[model samples]
Structure formats: C-alpha cells, structure tokens
Target: MKKLTSRIDKEKLLLAVAAPLLALVAALVVTALVILATGKNPFPAFNDMLSYGSASDSQVYILNKATTYYLAGIAVAIGFRMNLFNIGVDGQYRLAAFLAAVVGGALSLPGIVQIPVIILVAMLVGAVWSAIAGILKVTRGVSEVISTIMLNAIATAIIAYLLQPERLGQLDEAGTLVSTKPLPESSWFFTLDMGPAGQLWGFIVVAVVVGVAYWFTLGRTRFGFDLRAVGQSESAAAASGANVKKMIVTSMIISGAVAGLVGMPTLLNDSHQFDNSFPLGLGFTGIAIALLGRNHPVGVALAALLWGYLERTTGHFEVIGYDKEILGVIQGVIVLCVVIAYELVRRYGLKRQQQRVGAELAAQAAKTDTEVTA
Candidate 1:
C-alpha cells in the first residue's frame, strides 16, 4: 500500500510538471510559425531575448515587475479558488491606489505611522468595492462577472471625475499631466542600491510575505477547507453546515484586499503617486498568470516571473528592428496552450485514477475467491 501510494504521488507530480512543459513547447512552435509568416528568423530573436533578459539590470527590472504581477496574481487566484471570476481586480486596485495616494499625500507623519495607514485605507476601499459585487451575487442572484465588469467602468469614471486640479489631484508646473500629490520623501519605500544594476524594490519582501500567508491560510486552516468545499459544491458545503453566502462575500473581500496591494510597488517605489501613467489592464494579466500557475502560490510566483521575463525581453525586439507586436502573439499563444494542456492533463489523470481503482478492486476479489476455495 505504501509503495502504491508513493508511486501515485510520483505520477501526480510528473503530470503536474508535464502540463506546463507541454504548453511552453506548443507556444514556442506557434510563435515560431508566426515569426516565419512575418518573414523573420525567430531563433535569432529568441536568442537575443535570452541574452538581454539575463543581464543584471534587466534582472532588477524583471523583479520589480514581477513584484506587482505576483500581487495581482494572488488577488486573482483568491477568486479563482472560490470559483469566482473577479474581473473587477483592475478597478479595485486602481481605486485603492488612488485613494491611498490621496490620503498619503495629505498626511505628514512618521513613516511607521503613515505607511500602514495608507495601506489599510487602500485595503478597506478595495474590500468595500468588491463586497458590493459579492453582496449582489448572493442576495440578488446577479452574476459577479457582470457586476464586476460594470463596476470597473464606474471606477474609471469616478477616478476621472476626482482626478482634477480642483479636486484631489495636482498639476505639475509644466501642466501636461494631473496626478495625486506626490508622497513625501520620508514615506518612500526602501530599496537596495545595486549600483549599475539599478535599485531593487523593497516591496518584493512584502510580496513574499503575502505568498506565504496565502499558502498557509489556504492549505493549513479550517477556513481554507470550508472555502474549498464551498467552491467545489456550495450545496454540499451548506449540507455540511457551512454558511455558503457568507463564505462567498468573505472570499471576495479578501481577494479585493489583496488586489489593493497590487499597485503598492509602483506607487511607493517608483511613481510615488497615482497618475495617468499608472499601469492599466494588469488585472487581465493577472488572470493569465493565475491560470498559468493553477492558482498555487509557488506556481503563481513562477508564472509572474515568466510574465515579467516576457515583457522585459520583448521590448528589446523593437530596438533590434523586430515588430513589438510579437509580444502579444506570444502571450496569447502561451495562454491558449496552457489552457488546453491543463485540460488534457486533468482528463488523463482522471482516467489513470479510474484504472488504478478498477485494478485494485479486481485483485481484491480474486484473492477473496482463492481464500474461499482453500
């Protein structure tokens, strides 16, 4: 029994690894074909990307980018685990960052006091915004997908209205752009001076902490078990005495709270304000990363790094006379491949399990018949 169990575990691990590998290979092939159709040698571009992306400066950039991506991925994964499609992550993070920046800019306090306050405000705002969708889903039978998408539009409009010179925003002396007031120098997050390699954002440490917390909460706690049970089958969970409606709302709030952190790396370490230049569409990217990672913490981290790598390397293509649009093609292909590969692997695993169970039952029956004959 022990040997059989060990074998099964090993097989499962192999299957898990195989899915990503298969997806990557398929993506590469498709990308190569697309490049060929464009009358370019894809191998040279691939080699150049590998070389450029491995440079020390590039590594720093990738880490900073991955920090944001990791946070976004975690926020989306939280929703994915609960069988929830939280398309509002973009709005949630943007609103959180905007409000947090406004509050931080208005306050002058010790770093220890002000930073936490800003973060808390962001989380609270994000939770409230997402909870609206959750409450509607549970009470009014509205689809979260529809509500979250609509909320995104509303959030955009609100930001546009509030980000005026007469409102919470400020215009620079040049008058070309409007943004929230810049955070004080004292409130600036720490960084590691890597000399020519550039500065590494301290927010990477925060991302690591978030990942650890996510793993512990989801894998080791009773609440995690209930959440997973409800995700699998809400009716079954309710039959088992779980509060289905409450779980849905709580999960959304938690997901949004994390989503609030997605902009911190940029706001604190680089931009220091919420502005027109703040990244958009990151919530959509997070969905891809979450799917690629299968919603596991370590896997999500790796997927985030991969995303950063692709973005970092692909920009160099334009400088080398290659079309920058290749990035979109590659990313889209990879996501599609990942989806297909995982589904195939899942079906294969299910078939293997069924076979194993049938064989075990047959052997048990044969042994019983032999014993009766004896």
Candidate 2:
C-alpha cells in the first residue's frame, strides 16, 4: 500500500512536467508542417530566430518584453484562478497607464513619491474599469466575458477621445504624433547600464516584485483559499459560508489592478509618457501566456520568456524576407496544444490514482484472507 502511494505520487509529478513539454514539442512539429505548406524551409527560419534570440542585446530586449508580458499574464491568471475571464485587461491597462502618465507627468513631486503616486493612480483606474464589468455581472446577471468585451470597446472609444491633441495630449512638433506631456525626470524609471548594447529597463524590479506578491497572495492567504474554492464550485463555496458575489467582484478588481501595471515597464522606462503608439493587445498576449503556463507564476514566467523570445526573433525573420506571421501561427498552436495536453494529463493522473488505491485495497484484503485461512 505504501509503495503504491509513492508510485502514484511520482507518476503525478511526472505527468505534471511531461504534459506541457510534450505539447510544446507537438506545437513545434505542427508549426514546421505549416511552414512547409508555405513553401519555406522552417529549419533556417527557426535557426535564425534561435540565434538572434540568444544574443546579448537581444536578451535585454527579451527581458524587457518578458517583464511586460509577465505582468499581463499575472493579471489574466488572477482572473483564471477565479474562473473569471477579464478580457478587458487591454483596455484597463491602456486607460490606466494613460491617465497615470498624465497625472505623473503633471506632478512635481520627488522621485519616490511621484513613482508611487503614478502606480496608485494606475491601479485605481484599472480596478475601476474592471469593476464596471464585475458590478454588471454581480448585479445585473450579465456575463463577465460579455461585459468586459463591451467595456473594452467603450474603453477604446474613451481613450481615443482623451488622446486627441486638444484633450489630454498635445501634437508634437511634427504634428504627426500625439502624446501626453513627457514625465519629469524624477518620475521616469531609470535604466541600468548594460555596458555596451544599451541600458536595461529598471522596471524589471517591478516585475519581480509583482510576481512575488502574486504568488504570495494566491498561495499564502485565506483570501486565496476562498478564491480557489469559489473557482472550484460556487455552490460548494457558498455552502461553506463564502460570499460568492463578493469573491467575483474582488477577483475582477484585483485582476484589473494588476492589469494596470502591464504597460508600466514600457511607459516609465522607454516611452517616458503615454502616446498613441503605446502598445495595445498585450492583454491578449497575457491570456495566451497564462494559458500556456497553466496559470502558475513560475510557469507564466517561463511562458512569457518563451513568447518574448519568439517575438524578438521576428525582426530577424522580417529582415531575411521570411513572413513574421509564422511565429504567430506557432504561438496560437502552442497555446491550444498546451490546454489540450493538460486536460489529457489530468485524466490520466486520475485513472492512475484510482488504480493505485484499488490495488492497495486488494493487497490488504488478500493479506486478511491469508490470515483467516491460517
């Protein structure tokens, strides 16, 4: 019986690691097939990407990109852990970052105070944006997915209005670009010198801090347990005295607040202000990374790094006349494959666990039978 339990535990551990890995391998193979159909030699493209992504300068790019992605993934994962899909992360971050940029840019506070003030504003706005959908879901019986999608559209419109030169922004000397006032030097996130290639964004610290906080919040707190319980089953959680509606609203707000930070790495470090060209769609990428990582913080980090590496490799492909769209295809395939693989592995683990328990019971019964016969 003891041996059977040990075996089952080891098998479960193996399955957890093996499932995603096999899925990744399958995704690569499928991507190769797609490239062949396009009449391109996939190997050379793959080689180029791998080589470029491994370069020192490219590593900094990957790190910066991955930092942003990490925050986004955590934002989505917060929703995922609660079985809530907060798709408006894109809108939430965009609006929050813009507002924060405007506020921070206007402020004349010291470096320490200015940075936190900007972050606070972003979080508040992001939470408010997401809370709109959460409120509708809890109060009006609206689906979060639907509400958040609508909110995203609304957020985009609002951002467009706010971004006009006569509104929260001003036209640059070229009159071709619209951006918020540049942030004060005190408020800008300083970069670290990388000796040669360039300076690494200081917001890497922010990413690490957020990641640690996320893990701590989800793993070490009563609220985390309650969130997971609600996710597992609302009916069960309610029976145990958990407030279902409260959890949903709170989860969405938390998700949104984190989503607010998704743009900070770029905003504070590189752009130093919000602009029309500020990145959009990072929220969607976060969802993919969250799914790819199975919503674990560590897994999410790895997935973000992989995704960033792939993205940074695209410049090489574009330079070499290969279509950059192939990377997108691979990313989509990998995400789909990871989900399927996890489900399959979960079922296999369940079956094996049941078999292990049955085998142990049988052995115990046989021993009893021998004792009675003796």
Candidate 3:
C-alpha cells in the first residue's frame, strides 16, 4: 500500500509536466483529423512542416522569432508572478522599438557605443510606459489590467503621432507610411555568418543574459523575496514590514524593461527602423506562451521555440496546397488544451496534497491512541 501510494504521488507530481505534452498531442491529433476530412494526407503535410521547421536555415529563422517571443513572454511572466496583469506589453515594446530606432538613426558613433545606447534608451522608454500603469494601480487603486489596456491604446496613438516627419524623420521622402528613418549599417547587429543558417547571434546572447539576470533578480535578491511574499499574501507581507507598493512598482518596471528587449531582434536584425507594421501582435501571443511555459525561464524559452517553429512552418503549408489558417486553429487549440490541462493538474495536485495531509493526521491519531492504551 505504501509503495502504491508513493507511485500515485509521483504520478500526480508528473502531471504538471505531462499535461502540456498531452495537450500538444491532442491538438495535433485534432488537426490531423481535420486535414484528413478535407481529403489530404495529414501525415505528409505534417512531415513536410517538420522537415522545413528543422532545416538549418529554418532553425535560424525560428531562433530569431523565438528570441522575440521569449523576451515578450518573460515580460508577461514577471507580471504574472506578482499577480499583476501587464496588458501593455504591446505598447511598451512599440515605444521601446521607436526609441531604439530613433537613437540608432541619430547616432554616428562606433558599433559598441551606438548599440548599447540604443538598447538602453529603448529599455528606459518601455519601463517608464509600464510604470505609469503601476503608479495608477498603487496610487488610485486602479486595476493594473484595465490601466495597462488603456495605456496600450494611448501608446499606440503616441507612436502614430511620433511617426510624423516633424517628430521623427520618415523612412520615405514622401512620409506616406508611418515609420522612422533607418539606422546606420554600423548600428545593426552582426549576423552569425554561418552560411544560410546564419542568425542574429547578438539577440540570442542578449536573451541569455537577460534570462540569467531575471533569474537572479527573482530568485536570489532581497527584493525578489519581498515581491514573492507580497504575491503570496499582501496583508501578511505588509505586516512583516514589506513595502508592497514599492515591490509592485518595481516588478512592473522590470517587466517593461524586459519587454523592451523584444524589439532588439527586429530592429537590430531585420528592419532597423520603427514602422507601424513591425511590432505585430507579439504581445498577446506572449501571454499564451508564458502560461504554457508555467512562467519559468527555461520553460518559456522552450515554449517560445515551439511556437516559433509552428509559425515558421505554417507558412510553408500554403506551398503544399493547404490552408495556412490551419496554423491559427492549431495555435488556439493548443492554448486551450494547455489551459484546461493546467487547471486539471493543479486541482489534482491540491486534492492529493489534502489526501496526504489527512492520512498523516489519521496515522498520528492512531499512534497516539496506541500509546495511551499501552
């Protein structure tokens, strides 16, 4: 009985990891069925996607995409850890990209000087933008979710206004499109130079550095302890002399600063300009990635890689006469499945914990009775 109980307990703990894996499998099965219904060989289609997704050149593309997603995911995860919802990652990234582009374009210095300056300015811009929502939440009792959403809209408008020729010079002489002047070639990131498989190695380096810094900040720092305490119980944290408000604001700032890093891949690797079309909808997708990864740095990186692989391969489906919209469906299904699985596993764990505690209490009671009788 003891052995069986131990096995069951192990299985319950494994469920946290198993659930997402099962969700991915389930999603693929459903997708295959849908493809078969449409008179297509789902196996060949999937195999083709896999082949392309794993190719050397494709790996580089996916890695670049993963870098952006990972940074954005971390930003959302940081807020999630603090029980704060930062819905303004989109705005934060956009403003950061704009500032970075502006700084890069304006500078005429060496690569070392210009690159760091651009990145720093962008981070500062994003932090300030996100800090607004944090301040509103702390001071006026406004929900971060609502404030962040509204701030996102405001940031969008601000970016649009800044794209004007008078503010930031337009990319084209006519100023028809909403964009900033391109950066000097010296300001761009150095590519891997690994043939067709070459990638933005600088972005990957930055991601690793940021991930390490984030881990240290959250796991080893005094502020991290206070943030965790406040997250677990604000009232208790306050009673214990933790400044809950400061922690909340600090977390938000850090979240935004991390979010700003998302633009480095795009600005330094590809466009080198701030354009309306460049930012995309990465912020929202990042939230799903964060949840799927359980908000852990390693998990988030893996999740981002998976997402990037799917996105890159999905485009190839069109070449093989399949609908690319299937990718969207798959993404949505995966996210839904993962969410359901997480909730189920979480509840199961809670129940198991309760059961274990109850059993321990009963055993203690029996032992006491035995002692008293003897």
Candidate 4:
C-alpha cells in the first residue's frame, strides 16, 4: 500500500511536469506545419537555430538577450500574479533608462555610488509611472490595461521630447542618430570573460538575482500569499482581510520597479547611453514568455533562454534563402499551445485527485465493514 501511494504521488508529479513539455511538442508540430506551408523544411530551420545558437558568439548574445527578457518577464509576472494587466512596461523602462542616462552622464561620482544612483533613479521612475495606473484603479475603478496603454503613449512623448537636440540629447558624431550624452566610464558595467565571444553582460548577475528573489519571495513570503489570494478572487481575499486595495497598489509598484531594470543590460553594457534605437516591444514579448513559462521563475528562465536563442539564431534562415519571419510564427504557436495544453492538464489532474480521494474513502469503508462482520 505504501509503495502504491508513492507510485501514485510520483505519477501525479510527472503529469504536472509533463503538461508543459507536451505543449511544447504540440507547438513544434504546428510550427512545422506552418513552415511547410511556407515551402520550407522545418527541420533545417530548427537545426540551424539549435546549432548556430550554441556557438560562442551566439551564447554571449543569448545570455544578454535572455537577461533583459528575464527581467521583463519577471516585471510582467508580478502584475500577472495579482491579476493585473500592466501593459506599460515599454514606456516604463524606456523612460526610466532615459532619465537614468541623463543623470549618469551629468554626474561625476565614483562607480559604486554612481551606478547605484542610476539604477535607483530608474526604479523610482518606473514605480511612480506604474503607480499612476494602480492609484487610478483603486480610487476611480479605471481599467489598468487602458491606463497603462495610455501611459505608454505619454511616455513615448516624454522620451521624444527629452531626445531633442535642444533638450537632453544631441546628434551623434555622424549627425544622424539622436541620443543622450554618454556616461562616464564609472557608470559602465564590467563584462564577463567569454574568450572568442569577447564578453558577456555583467548585468546577467542582476538578472539571476532578480529571478531568485522573485521565486523566494513569491514561494515563501506572506505578502506573496495575500497577492495570490487576491488574484484568485478579490472578493474572497477582501472578505478574508487580505487588504485587496493595498495589494493592488503594492504589486503595481513592485512590478514597475522590476520593469525599470529591463533596459539596464543594454544601457550599461552595450550602448553606455540611451538612444532612440534602443530595442522596443520587449514589454509585449514578455507577456508571451510569462505565459509560456507559466509564471514560474525557473520556467521563465528556460523560456527566456529559448526566446533569446530563437532570436539570435533565426538569422541563419536568411543565410539559407528562408524568411526570418518563420521564427515569429513558431514563437506565437508555442505560447498558444502551452496555454491550452496546461489548462487541459490542470483539469485532468483535478479529476484524478478527486478519484484518488474517492477510492481511498471507499477502501476505508470496506475495511471497517469487514472488521465489523468479523
């Protein structure tokens, strides 16, 4: 009986883990079909992504890209856990990075003080920006999605204004691209040694720390429980004295603070300045990654790597006369399939759990009846 119970427990665990993997497999099948429809062999495309993405140079790229993606995913996940839709991370990070760059360039402090100051400025800006939506939601019942979307527009205008030559920016040496003044070397991040790959972003450490913190806080903290309770049902959480309004505002601020760090990898390591050409759309991409990872920190890490690897290696398709857009198709398919597959498996697991309890109760009743007869 003990062995059977152990086996059943293991089976349950296996099913829980297998659901996402099965979804990924389904996603591949659908992606392959899409590739076929485009008159390209899916195998070669996938092969190129796998092989090239493992190269030293590609590894560096993947690591850096994943770092930023991981941050963005975490930022989005914070709000997701509270059933909040924070659609303004794009604006939040961009505005934060721009302001940080402006401050870092103007200051002449030591690296220790300067870097922290820059980062703190970014977090403060991001938190304030996100708090606007949260405040509106709690006080006036504004939809966060709408408010955030509008905030994005506002942020864009702010960035554009700040980037003006007469404002916080000037043209590059080439007199074409407009960007903020470059920061002093003290504000720049150190790079990790990677031999032929040259170097990897030091901000990768920050990303790891963020992921670990996210996992620990959510899995072990009382605040996390209240946040989740509110997410599951705001009415029930309020009835249980979870302070639903406070959770909403606190979660949004936390989410935005994390979002503020999303651009640090690129800003401190690659560009050393905030430019108009900085990567955009990472905020929206994070939504798919968060969904694909099921909002688990470890899962988000893997999902980030997968996403970055796909992005880094997809150029191989262009080398072989194939369209690079196929990568997007595969990525989208993966997210969709994973969501559906997980839902199905969740329902199945619930049913199996019910069955197990019923059988155990029935066995207990039969044993009692036999003992009574004896």
Tell me each candidate's TM-score.
Answer: 0.98, 0.97, 0.91, 0.96
Sort every candidate by lDDT, greatest first: 1, 2, 4, 3
Cα lDDT tens digits, model 4, 1-374, are 57558867886788868888898899889988888888878898788777898789999989889999999999999999999999989889999999999999999999999999999999999999999999999999999999999999999999998798999998998999998989999889889988999789999999999999999888899998899999999999999889999999999999999999998999899899988789899899888888887788988888999899888888568778788787888788888888889899888877887788788879989999999999
Please, what is the whole-model Cα lDDT of each candidate in the order they appear? 0.94, 0.90, 0.86, 0.90
Count clashes in each candidate, considering only residues at least 3 apart in sequence or on different chains: 0, 0, 0, 0
Q: How do the residues 1-374 of candidate 1 rate in per-residue lDDT, one tens digit apiece?
A: 56667877888999999999999999999999999999999999999989999999999999999999999999999999999999999999999999999999999999998888888888898999999999999999999999999999999999999999999999998999999999998888899999999999999999999999999999999899889999999999999998999999999999999999998889989999999999999888999999989999999999999999999999878889789999999999999999999999989988997788788779889999999999
Candidate 2's displacement at residue 225, Å, is 0.3
Residue pairs in steric clash, candidate 1?
Answer: none
Residue-by-residue lDDT tens digits, candidate 3, 42-103: 99888888789888988888888899999999999999989888889988998889878987
**lDDT against true structure, model 2:** 0.90
Whose TM-score is greatest here?
1
lDDT by residue for model 2 (287-368), tens? 9999988889999999999998988887667679787788789889999899899999999899889987988899899999
Candidate 3 colliding pairs, count: 0
Model 1 TM-score, all chains together: 0.98
lDDT of 3 at 33: 86
Best by lDDT: 1
Candidate 3 Cα lDDT to native: 0.86
Q: Which candidate, 2 or 3, has the higher TM-score?
A: 2
For model 4, the stretches where C-alpha displacement exceeds 4 angstroms are 1-8
